[model samples]
Target chain A: MIPDDALVTATWDDLIERDGQALALSGNDVSLLSELATAAVLFCAEGDATVSAIAAHLEELFGAPEGADTSAAVREVLTTLQNRGVVSITG
Target chain B: MPWESGTAFRVLIVDAGNQGRSAVGERLLRRHLALNGIPADVIRVTSAGLNADDGLRMDVGAAAQVERLGGNAHGFRTRSVSAAMVEAATMLICGTWWEREELCIRYPRARGRAFTLSEIAHLYEELAVAAPIFDHPRLLDSRLRSSEVPDDFDLPPWEEFEERIVAVCDAIDEATRWIAEIWASMVPHHPQPKADGEEAAEPTCTLDAFGVAVAITCGGSAHEALSIAGKRAWGRCVVEDREAEADLTIVVDPDPDVLADARLTGALAYQDVDTALHHLSSAVTVRAIEARVGQLIMMHAAGLAGPDGSVVGFVAPSGTGKTTLSRTLGAHYGYVTDETLAVAPDLTVLPYAKPLSVIDALTHVKEQWGADSLDLAPLPDAPLRLTRLVILDRRENGPSTPVLTRLGHLEGIAMLAEQLSYLSKIPGQLHALSDLVDAVGGLSLLTYRDVKTVLPLMPVLLAGSRR
Candidate 1:
C-alpha cells in the first residue's frame, strides 16, 4: 500500500477545489506537474510502489517516445512537493 | 541574404543620418507591420543614416512625433548605414530621394533595391490601380524588383514635419497589406494543426510580455492554456522556466483528489490549471502581478508622462472614470501605463505598456487591446519620473469644469492606499509611499464629470505641481 505519509491528501483536496478557478502557473511548472500527474496516477494504481518502480514505469511509457529523462523529472517533482511540505517523502 | 533564405525578410530604412527622419520612419514602418498582424521576428525592421553619427540617440522631437502616431520611440540609437546593412536589406526605403542617390552611389548594388518612401507609396498605388486584387507584399516585391527608380516629391516645410510623417506612415500602411500577405505565405505550417473547438492537449505558459515574471506551477494542459492566454493578454512577457525566482509564485494544483482534502496549507492551490487561470483573469492578473511587484518595488498611481519625463498618475478606485480620463489624456500626453505605474525607489517610472483593457458593451467583459490598435500614441523615449498625482473624484452632472485642489501627504497616502496593489505586503510601504509623495510633492483633487472639461486645466495642474 502507498505510505500513509506519502499521499498529499489535504493539499490534493484544496487543489481540486481551486481547479477551474483563477490561479496562475508558469509555463514550465505547468508542464512539469502535468508530467508528474500522469506518472502519479500510474504509481497510485499499483497500490504499493516505490519511487524507483514509478520512475521505471514512467520511463517505459514516456522516455522513448518523448526522448526525455523521466527519472530526473520524477525526482524533481517529488523533491519539489516534499520541500514545499505539500507531500511527505517516506522511503 | 536573410530574406533570400525564405526564413526572414529584412527591411532597412535609410536616411541622411540616424536619429531623425529615418529613425521615425523605422518606428512607423514597424508599427504598420505590427498593426497588420505581421510579427517582428519574421520581418525585421532597422534604420541607418547615410552620414549618421553612430550611437547618437534619436531626436526628441522626432521620437515624440513617432509616439504621437502610435509608434514606439524607445530604444532608438543612431547608426550610420553600413555596406553590410545595405547588402542584407531585401528592400531599402530611403527617407528622401537624396538619401536614395547617396545609397546608389555608395553601394551600387543597392541601386535596383533603393526607393524613396514616396516612391514605394506611388508604386503601391500604381500596383493597386493596375491589378487592384493583388496583395500588398507581392506588389511591394514587384516594385522592389523593377529597375525603375520613381522620382521623389518636394520635401515639405520643416514646420509640417508631423504632417509629413503622417503622410509617409499612410503610404507605408498601404504597402503593408502585401508585406503581411508575403509574411503569411512564408510561415511554415504546423504538421498537425489543432482542430476547431479543440482545447490544446498540452499546457504552454509564458510570462506576460509586458508584465512581470510569474512563477506558474500547474499541469501540462493548463500550461499550454496559460501560454495562449498570456499571448492574448500580455503580448511578449511570457517566459519559460521550470524554476522561476519570480515576484509571485502561483501554485496550481488542479487534481480533484488533492483539492478535496481540507488539510492543504502553504501556497495557494487551485483545483486545476484552468480554474486557476480563470481566477487570475477575472481578478485582472496583470494588475495583480503589478501590485505584487509593487510590494517588492515601489508602486505609484496610474497615469501618463509628459515630454519632460514627468508622470501624472490618476489615483481612483475602479469604475471611477480613470480609464476614460487616461484615454483622453493619452492623446495629448506621452501615454504611460493605464493600470499600474511601477516606479523605482528613485521614482523613475518603468514602461508597462500592456494593452489597455476596455469593457466590451455586448458581453460587459473587459477586453485587452494593444496600444497601437486603440490609436493611442506611444510613450516618448524619455526617463519617466513621477511628477504629479491627480485624485479623480468624478461626479455626474456635478461640475461643468474640473476643480483642482491640493491635498496634504497624509491625505494623499490614504487616498493612494486604496488603489495601491499589495500595500500590506510591502515592507516599509508607508515610508516608501511617503517618500514618493515628497518627491512629487502632494496630490491634486481632480473633481470633474467629463474628461473634456478637464482638458484646459491639465497645463494648470502640471504647472501647479511644480510650485
Candidate 2:
C-alpha cells in the first residue's frame, strides 16, 4: 500500500465533469475513470495518509455506495495510478 | 447577425524601418480585405510620429472624413504640413495612448478612456516590429528587458536571445496566416448587382477585435483617454496633406524590462501577433460593414478524449485551480481550453486547451513532475476535444473524493451563468450565454488539501460516471 505522504505530481491539460461523468487531462492524453477513482486520484496528494484513510474520507464525503469492498477498490485504483506515474506509493 | 453592424472605416499602420515587416503586414491586410470581399476606400500614411507625410490620397477628405471618421484631424497632422493646415484639419487631437498621471488626476474623464494596460503592451509589440523606429535593425529581445531591469538595457548574450527572436519572427508570420483564415470565414463577397436594376450599396464593418468601433476617437493621452472613460470614442477627420486619422492611438515610455518580459519565450506576446491579425480582419475592404464582436470562443473545454477514446472535461471558474488541475493531469487525459470551451451550434463541445497558468503557491506539482514537464506554452498551440465541465473549487479540506452529482439542464444553465464575459451587455449577449449553459452539464468539485486525494479516482472518472 502506498503511504499518503507520497508526492505524486503529474501534468494535466484539462478536467471535465458532465452529469455524473468526468474526464482528466495528463500531458496530451485523456483518461475516463469512475467517480471513486476520481476521488482516489485526487487523494494521491495527501501526505502520510493511508489508503484506508483516503477511502474512508471519500466514503464519508461523497457517500460512496455501501456494501462494496472499499479498501480493495482503493488499493486497485491506487496501484493503477502508480503504474501510470500519476501517483506513487511510499512509506 | 452575431453583432450590430458598423460603419465604413480604414486604418494605416506604418513602421519606421524594415520595409520587409511592413510589407508582410500590409500584404496580410490586403489579403484579408480580398477574402472579405468588402469594398472600402483606403489610403496609406507612411510618415512616422506626429509629423511627416507620404501623400497617398483617398476619395474621402476633410469634412467627409470627419463625418465618417472623427471630427478632429490631429490623427492626420503631418510634420510636413503647416500648423495652420494641421489645426484646420483638426490634426492635433490626442490619440488614445498619450496620457500622464497628473492629467488623469486633474481630468477624471481620462481614467477609463485610454487603452487597457494589456492592450498597450500589445500595441508596443506591433509598433516595435511594425517599423524600425530608426533606420537600424535592432534586435528586440524580451529576455533583456524586464520591469526589474534598467531602461537602456544591454542586449543579452547573442546566442541565447538570437534563436528566440528568430522563432518569434516565424510565429508572427503564422499569426498572419491565422488572421487570413478568420477574415475568410467572416467576410463574404458583395453579391453582384442584379442584371436588371440598380445595385444595392453593401454596408461595411467598422469595429476592432475588442468590440470597440474603429471610428470611436480613442483619446490622445492616457489621462485624456481615462477622462472619457466608458464613453464612446470621438471620431477623427482626415486632412488632405496630413497623416491618416487614427481612431485609437498609443504611446509608451520605453521600458527595457517590460519590453524584455514581453519578448520572453513561450510568452503570450508571441500569441498577440496572431490576435492583432484579427483586428486587421475587421478592416477588410471587400465588405465595408464592420461587425461589433468581442467574444472569440477559442476552443471547447469538454468532450476530452482519453487514450482509449473515452472523454471528459475540466471546468473551473477563472483564477480557480483549473489550469493547475489540468497540468497535473499530464499525459493521462487530453486537454481543452484553460479559459473557455467553444460549443458548436450543435450540442458538441469543442476544446480550447491552451497554456495552463501555474501559480507560485502550487509548488508540489513542480517537485513531483520535473520542471521541464510543467513548461506550458501560450493558448494558440494547445487544442483538445471536450467532453464535460469539471468545475474545480478550492476547499480548505484536503483533496476530496470525486463526487458524481447530476444536474438538470435548467440547473446547468444556472451554474454556467457566471462563466460568460460581460453579463451586463445587451439582451443578445445574455441570450447567447444562456444558450451555452443549456448545452453543457455542470458540476461542483471541492478540491482537497492534498494532491494524493484526487489521484486514486482518475481511472474511474476516465471511464465515465453512473447516475
Candidate 3:
C-alpha cells in the first residue's frame, strides 16, 4: 500500500551492486530488488514521486507492453519496497 | 576478510651471540629490503641472541663477511633477546636448531613463527617451486603457522665445520642471501623504471582500515610522510602486499596510467605530503565507510567495548561530545571508533579503527590521530557485539550525575534511523532495528552535563538493566 507524503529513501549511488543485482541496505536489512523494482524505488527516492508519476515514468522508460496496466504494476513494486523497508510510504 | 599484516616485515634473528650468524643475516636482509625498494624505516631487520653480550661489536668474522657482501657492519651491536623482540618479530630466524626450540619454549606466542635459518632456506626452496606462493603474499609470514615443525628440526647440524670457526656461520651466510631473495620475489619493486643514475622507486604499502584494503604509493616528501603515517596511525592495519583486491588506491603525485584498475582512487596532485596527508585521511575515512554499505549497519557514533567484547555504542549526532566522551570511555573500555561504528545483523561490531579526528583547542583544526596516540585502550581479542545503545543528550547544567532513561520503540527507532547509513539497502530494516532495540533492553537516553558523568553509567548500561 503506497502512502501520500514523502518517500524516505537512499540514493541509487548508495545501493550495493553485486552479481548483476543491486542491494538496497538499511542497517541490518539488505533487500535485493529486481531491475524494475529498483527503478521504482530510485524514482520515488526523489522525495515527491507519486504512484501515477512512477507508473507513467516506468511505462515510458521500459514502454507499456501492449496496453498493460502499469499503474497497478507500479503499486506492486512500491508495496514490495515498502515491505522491505527500502523506502517508507509516509502520508 | 583474511588477516592483514599490520606490522612491517620485522625479522629478528637469534643465535648464541647476536654478533655472528644473526648479525650477518640481519645485514643481508636489510640489503634485500633496500634492493626491493622497501624503505628501511618501514621494514625492520635486526638480530638478538639468547646468550648475547649487550653493546658488544659485531663478531670479527661476521663484520668481515658483511663488508665482503658489500654491506657495512660498523654500527652493528649485540644485545640479549627480550620477550618484546620475540613478540614483535614477524619472522624469527635462528642460527641453530636449539635456538628455535628454546625461543618457542620461552615465548609460546612465537612458536608459530620460530624457524631455523636452514629450515627457512629449505622452505624457500620448496615454496619457490610452488609458484602459487606469489599469489599468497602473507603465506611467507604464515607458512610457519600452517606448516608443522619438522620432527628433526631440533637436531643440530653443521654445514661447514673445517672452513669456518663456527659450524653454522657458513650456512648462515648462504641462507641469508636466500632469505633476501625470497623477500625480493615476494614484494617486487615498483613499476617506475630506474632512470640513468636514479634509484628505484619505493615499494607500495597495503593498509586495512575498517575492512577496507587501501594501497598507497608515492615518492619524495609524500612517501616520507606516508611512511611515518603508516607506522604511527595505521600501524596495526599495514599488510605486506595487496593480497586482496584493494578497495581504494591512495596515490600521491602518481604517474598517469598507473593503478588504472583500482575500484576507487584518491590521487594527491601536489607534493606537499604533510597537507596531502590531512586530505588523505579524509579520503580513507570516506571510502572506508562507503565500502561497508551492504555489509555493516554503521552508525555515526563512538563505540567502546568491554573486555568481554560487549560494545556500548554511544549513538549521537556529530558535535554532541561523542569524540570527547570516547577518549574518557576508551581509557576504561576498548575504543572501537569515535566516528563510525559498523555492526553486523547478528549484533557483532566491526572495528573501524580510523584515526581519531580530534580538534586542537588552540589551532581549532581537527587533527587526525591514531587511537594509540590518544592513549585509548586497544580493542580486545574477543568478538565484539552491540550489547547496549546509548543516545547521548548533552546540555549545559543538565545533570551532575548522568540520567539513563529508556525510550519507547517508536521514538528510539526514529532517533536510531537518523544516525544510520544506507537504510534503503536493508530488507525488513525497521522491524530488525526495533527488534535490536528490544534485544538491547531499549535505547537509553543519557543526559549529562559533563563527559565524566556518562562514565559511571557504562557499567549499568552494559549490564542490560531495563530501567
Candidate 4:
C-alpha cells in the first residue's frame, strides 16, 4: 500500500514538485515494506475501486463469485499494508 | 607457451595505478563471470616490478579473456607493450574478429591478423590525418618518396589518390563489420552436440534491484531469453562464453571498466553484447516503464494511445470496458499496446494496442473485436501513437458516457510515479519524472457501460494535440 498521501505520481521523466516547485527525493523515498504491500494491494484491489473502497465493498463484489474469498484477499492486502504503515486499520 | 601459441589474446589496463577503482573493476569482472556461469581460472597479473596493491589483474585460462587495459581501448599506451598489440590479443581471446573479404571465413590460421589489418588502416589514416600527402602526393616531400615504387605511379592526382585512401578506409570498415558479425554470432552461437549426455548446468543470474526480482537464466538459448526479459524489466545483463558446452552465455559483468577491457582483447562482439544490454536496460525499457506509469499517474487513471498515431485512446482500468472499447478502437487506430499506453512528454498517449492477450477467449473484448482484428505484434516494433485519451468505467445496462476532468500538475505527476520501476538511487530521477508529467496534458475520461459508447470522444482528445 503506497501511502495515499506520501505517494507522488509523475510522468516517466517528469520532475517531482511541491507547491509548484520541483522537489527532490533521495533513497529515503522508498520503503521496502510498502513496495511489497503495494503489489499485494494491486493484486487484491484491482477489480473496480480504490483500496479503501475494496475493503468496504468486499462482500458485495466477491461474496457471490464462485470459489471467491474476497475477505481473505482483502485482509491479506490490509495486513501487508498495515504492517508497512500504509494503512491505519488491519480489519 | 607453444601449447597456446595459436590462441591470441591481449591484456589492457588503463590507470591501473588507481588502486581503489582498479580493485572495483576487477571485482566487477569476477562477479560478471560468476553471474554468467563462465568457467575460467581467475589469474590476476600483478608483477613484482609494479606495486602489489596497485597493479593490474588479468584473468587467463582455457576460456577467452576480455579485459580493459585503461579506461579507453583506442587510446591507451603501455611502457612494455603497444596498445595495438594488447587490442589484438583481446580480439583473439574473445574470438570475435575475423576475415572481411571472405564473409564466411571462420578462425583463420593467423592469431592477430584481423587486428593487424585494422592497425594498418589506422596507420594510413593517421598518416592522412598528419599530412594530406597521401591524397595529394604532390605535397609529399621528395625525401619521403619510396624508392620501391616508380615515380610516375608514386605521385598520382589528388582525387585518384584520395579515392585509393577511401577504398582502404572502406576495406578497414568492412573488416570491422566482419569481425563484429563474428563476435555477435558468438553471443547466440553454441555447438549442437546431439543434445545428449549431461545437459550443462543452467547458469542463473539473480539481480535484485532493491527488491525487484530479476532472475536471469543462462543455458543453450535461455541466456538470450533472460537478456530479453531483463531488457524489458530495465535491468543490467551480461554474457560470458566458456567456448565449450556454452558457446554463448549471458553474464552480469557490472564492471564500469569492462568496456575498456573488452576493447583490449578486440572482442567487438562481446563489447556489443554489453552495449546492447546497456541500451535495453537503461534507455529503451526504462523509458517504456516510465511512460506506462506516467499514463497511469498523470491521466485519469486511464491508459490511452492511438495505434498508428491516428485514433483515440480507450482509457480504463482493469475490468472496466477499457479493453472491450480498446478492441473496437483498435480496429480504427491499429492497436499500439494492449495492456499499456506510451504517453509521450508532449501530452500524446501513444497507443500500444497490440495483440489482445485474452485469457478467456469468450470475453467481450475477444468476442466482438475478434482474434484476427487485434494487432498481436510485439510492442517494440508495433505501430501506434496518441490522438486522444478516453477514460472508461463500466455501467451495466447504461449508455456509455464520456466525461473529462482536468488533471493538474502535482496530481498528474503523482499518478504516473506509481509505475516507476527503475527508481534506483539516481539523482536525476525525481526531477526528470516531474518534468515529464508537466509536459503531457493530463485528463480523466469517464466511460459508460458499452465499449462503443466511447467512440464519439476520440476526436475531442485529438483536438488538444499540438502535433
Candidate 5:
C-alpha cells in the first residue's frame, strides 16, 4: 500500500476507453482499468496529489460498494497501477 | 514510453513540403520535453516533408509563431520524408490528413504509428502531464464491434497494426475537421456559409445483388445528376421493385455546404458527385461486407461463373488485372464482383456486381462502368457455386501457356488470408476458411504472361465451364 502522504502522478499519455472499458497505454503495453481505477488514476494524476487525497476523491466519485472494504480496494488499485507503470508514487 | 528508457523512442513530425506546420511541431515538442525536465538526448524530435527541397528553412510566419510560443526554431532545416525516416520513427505526426494518408498508403507498415499534429498534441499533453483527466472523450472507438470480447489485446502484430491504421485513418479524418474549424475561427473575416442541400428530390433506385442490397435515396443539390449517373454506373445491381427492403441505405448528396456541415457533424460527406461516387464503391463494398461479416466468407477477389454455374474466384493484387480478366472472360460467363466476392459456407456464391472502376488513360480518372454498359455477361438464373480459387501470378517474361500449380493447405490459407476482411470476428474464422479451402478440393496459383493465355485454361480449370 502507498503511504497516505506519498506523491502520486500518472505516467500515461492517453487513456483510451473502448467498449465500456478504459485502457491506459504505454508504448505497446496496454493496461485495462476498471471505472473506479480510472477515476482514481485521474485523481492521482493531478500535481501534488497524495494517496489520501486520491481516496477522498474516489469517495466522492464512487461510494463504497456496500461493505467491500473501500480503502483496501483503493490501496489495491494504487498498488496495481504502480506495478503497471501507469502511476508513480514517491515519498 | 519511459522517458529515460534505453529503447530509442523518436517522434517525427511531417508536412507536405515541411515549411511550416511540421517545423512548429518539432520545435514545440522539443521545448515541451525540455520544460518537463526530459533531456533532448532521451527523446528525439525531427520534421520532414513528403517532397521537400533538401535545404529550406522554416517558414517565416511559422518561425515567428514558434518564438511567440517560447520555442526556438533557429536552425530547423527541412528534410525529405524518406523510407528510412518512416522506419526510424517510433511516432510520425503530420500536419494534414492527406500527408498522413499518403504516407500510410506508401508505407502501410507505418499506418499504426502515423498521427496528425493536432492528434499527437492532445496525446502529448496527456502523455507529459497526464493533465487532470476529466473523462475526455476517446479519440476513436474500437474498430471491433460491441459484441467482440475485450480480448483485443491478443491480436497478432500485423492484425493489430491493420486495425490501428484503419482506426487512425478514421480518427485523423475527424480530427482534421477540428483543425479546419479552428483555422476558420482564427481568421477574423471568414466567408459566409454556403447554401444547404435543399434542391428538389431526384429519382430513387434500389440496388440488390449478392444478398447485399442498398437503397439509394437522392437528395441535395445536383441530386438528379448524381442519381442518374449512379443508376447508369450501377445498372447491373438495380432491380425493378423500388419497394424492396435493403440491408443498407445510402443517401447520395453532393452539396458543398451540406458536405461541410456533414464533416462537422461526423457524417460521411463528399465535396462533389464524382468524389461521392468514387469513394462510394469501396465504402458500400465494405459496408456490405460488414453486414455479413460473420455470415459469409468474403475475399478481395474477382468472381466469374461459367454457363453451368461453376464460379471461379481469382485473387490478385492491384495493377495485376483482376478487373481486366473479369471484364474479358466475363463475356462468356456471369460476372460477379471484381472487388469483393462473398460465399456462404455451403459454397453458394453471392455475386456483388458493382460498377467497375476502370482507369481512363486520357483523363487519368478511374471511371465507373456498369457490367451491362460494358457488355459483360449478366448474372444467370442458374444458382452459382464456388468451384475453384485461383491466385493470379502475373509476370512479363513468363510461359506462353498458363500453368496451374496446386497450392498446399497452409500456403493457400496464408496467401488468401492477406485478402480477406473482418474474418477474425467470425466464429472459428481460420477453421472456416480452411474448411472452404478443403471443400473446394484445393486452391491453385495461376502463373501466366497474358490474359489470352489464361483464357483457354478457364474451361478446364473451372468446373461446369461450357456445360
Candidate 6:
C-alpha cells in the first residue's frame, strides 16, 4: 500500500490556497504527477509491490515507446516525486 | 557681482587627440542626455584633446558616425585639454583610461575630477551599492580616482563603431537617470505656494507598482517609514492625505486592545504603527497591496526592458529568486519592477522602478532598498511593450545548468495565472492571460538553481518570443 506521507494529499489548488502561489507546481510537473498518480492508485490496489513490478505494470498499461527504457523512466519519475516529498518508497 | 549665475553642470570629454575619441564620446554623451530629457541648459557638454593642435576638426569617420546618431558634427573644432579647462569643468570624462591618467599627471588637482567613460559607469555601479544617497556626479568629482590605467581595447570598424556608440549612449542615458532619481529623492519636496488666496487642495495618494498607498492619517514615524518605502518603490508617486481614497489606510491606534489586535477592516487598518512597522516585512506589505489591487489585472513579476523597448517579464511566486535574477540581469536590460509588474490592456509595462526588497540578515525581513541603490540601469522613459515571459522554477539542489523549455499557449496561461496577483477579481483573467500568451506566442519555463547559469540564457529567452 502507498504510504500516506508519500501521496500528495492536497490538490494543486488546495496546495496553492494553503501555502500561497509559490507552492503551485508547473504544468509539466502537474502532468507528470497525474501520470504517476494513476500508477500510484493502481499500485496501491495491488498492495506492496517491487519497483520493477510497478514499472512493468506502467509499461504494460501505457506501452513503452520504441527505444525507450520504461523501467528507467519509471524509476526516474518516482525518484523525482520522492525527492520533491510527493512520494516515499519502503522495502 | 557674480561672474556667471547658474552655470550648467559642465562636462569636458578629453582624449589624447580630440579629432576622434573625445569628439565621439562628447557627441554621444550630449545626444544621450538630451534624448533622455536632461535639459541642455542644465548640463553643458564639450570635448578637447590633450595633444591636439587648435582648430583641428573631428575625424571624418567619427564625425560621420556622430551624424548618423543624429548628433551635430558641424563646427566641432578640437580645443586642447588645459589645466584651466580641467578647473572649469564640473566633471571631466575621458575617452580612454590613458587619457584620464595623462590629464591627472599633468594637472594633479584634476585627479579626483577626471574619469574614463567606462570607469565612470563602473564607479556609478559601485557607488550605487556603497552610498546610494550621495549626489553621484559631485561624489565622483571629489572621491579618490583609481590609479589603474588599462590600455584601451581595439575599436571596431566604422560601421560597427556606431553600434558601440549607441551602447555607450544607452549606458550614459541609464546612468544619468539613475543619478538624477537618487539625487532627487534626497532633496525634500517643498509644496508650491497657493496663488491669489486659492484654497489648499486635498492631499492625493498615488500607488506604486504593487498598488500600495499610505494615507496621511498615519503617525509621523509611520509616514516617514512609508514615505521612504514608497519613494524606493514608486519614486515620487507616494502622496499625502487621501485617506478616504487610498487603497490601504494605516492609522496609529493608541488603544491597547486595538494595538494588540492588528485588525484589518476592508481597505483600512488600525495597528500600533511603530510596532507594526518594526515587525512588518516588505513581502507582507506587497501581499496586502496585491489584495487591495486584486480588482486590477496585475501579476507578481519582475519586469525588464530590452534595447528595442520590449519588456521581458519573469513571473514567479515569492522566494522564487525573481528579485535575485532581476538584479543580476538588470544591468544589461533596464529594470522595470521587481515586486509587481502591472500590465495595461495593450500589454505595455508601466515603469515602476521600485526599490528592491532585500532580506535582512538578522530579522530576515525583506527591507526595501531603493532602485537606485542597486547597481541596475534605469528604465527608459518610453512605454515598454511586453515581448516575453518566463515562468521561473528555481529550487534548491536543482539542476546546475538551467534548462529553458518552451510552453504552449494554454500551458503558459496556466503557469502565468498562478502568479497573477488578483486572478479572481478580474472578470476575464484567464482570457486576458491567454490573450497575452497568444500575443507573445509562448513562454519559457526556466528551471535552475544558480542565477549565473540562467544569466547567459536571458538574451536567448528574450529573443525566443520574437521567433
Docking class of 5: incorrect
Better of 2 and 3 by lDDT: 3
lDDT of 5 by residue, B1-467 (tens): 10223533467888788887677777777764443223444457798998888899988867766776677879888899887898677667777768888888776545657766555434432221100010011111111111122211122346585564344333433333332222221111111233597443233776775675656555556667778888898887877655533322223454556655443332234445665576556545644554575688877689998877888999864346688888888887789888778899998999888888777889977788889888998877899899888888878887888888988665676567655655444455666777788878788899988887777888876763223
Backbone clash count for every predicted candidate, in the order shown: 44, 147, 12, 52, 1, 2
Q: Against the true structure, what is model 1's DockQ? A: 0.01
Once model 6 is optimally superposed onto the true structure by TM-score, how far is the C-alpha of residue B320 displaced, in angstroms?
A: 1.7
The local distance difference test score of model 4 is 0.33
What is the fnat score of candidate 6?
A: 0.00
Instruction: Give per-model TM-scores.
Output: 0.38, 0.30, 0.46, 0.31, 0.52, 0.42
Stretches of candidate 6 off by over 4 Å are A1-91, B1-206, B210-217, B220-247, B251-296, B362-365, B424-429
Q: Rank the candidates by TM-score, best first.
A: 5, 3, 6, 1, 4, 2
Across the candidates, what are chain A's individual TM-scores? 0.46, 0.59, 0.73, 0.33, 0.82, 0.52
Per residue, candidate 3 scores C-alpha lDDT tens digits across B349-439 of 8776766656689987656677788888988889988888889888887989888888755566666765665554444565566667777
DockQ each candidate and list the results: 0.01, 0.01, 0.02, 0.12, 0.02, 0.01
- How accurate is chain B of model 5, given as a TM-score from 0 to 1? 0.60
lDDT of 2 at B112: 24
TM-score of chain B of 2: 0.34
Model 2: per-residue Cα lDDT over B1-467, one tens digit each: 32223322222322222122222333444443433333342211122122334442221322232222212223232223232332122001121223213223333222222221223233333322211111001112121122232221123445775554344334333444443333332332222234467542221113321122232222112323322321221111111232222232111113434323322211111122223222222222112122212333222132234564334555544334555565655444554334344443343444333233333465522111211245422222233323345545456564356454555543443344333322223133334444444444344343555444555656656554322
State which docking tier applies to candidate 6. Answer: incorrect
* Model 2 lDDT, residue B174, Cα: 44
Model 2: CA > 4 A from native: A1-91, B1-304, B308-310, B360-385, B407-409, B422-447, B463-467
lDDT of 4 by residue, B1-467 (tens): 11122332222222223232222222333333323222222212111111223223332210111122212112221222232433232321111122211211322221222222333323322222111011111111111222122111122346785554334333423433332332222221112233457564454544321112323333222346435544433322222332211122333334535533432322221233433343222222222332233223222122433333443444433334445555566455444444444444443444322223233556523111222434422222333344444444466755546456665544444333332333332234656555543433453435466657566765566554444
Clash count, predicted structure 5: 1
As a whole number from 0 to 100, the lDDT of residue B399 in candidate 6 is: 91
Error of 6 at A11 (Å): 19
Q: Which candidate should be chosen as best, given DockQ against the real structure?
A: 4
* Weakest 10 consecutive residues of candidate 2 chain B by summed lDDT: B130-139
C-alpha positional error of residue B464 in candidate 6 after TM-score superposition, expressed in Å: 4.4
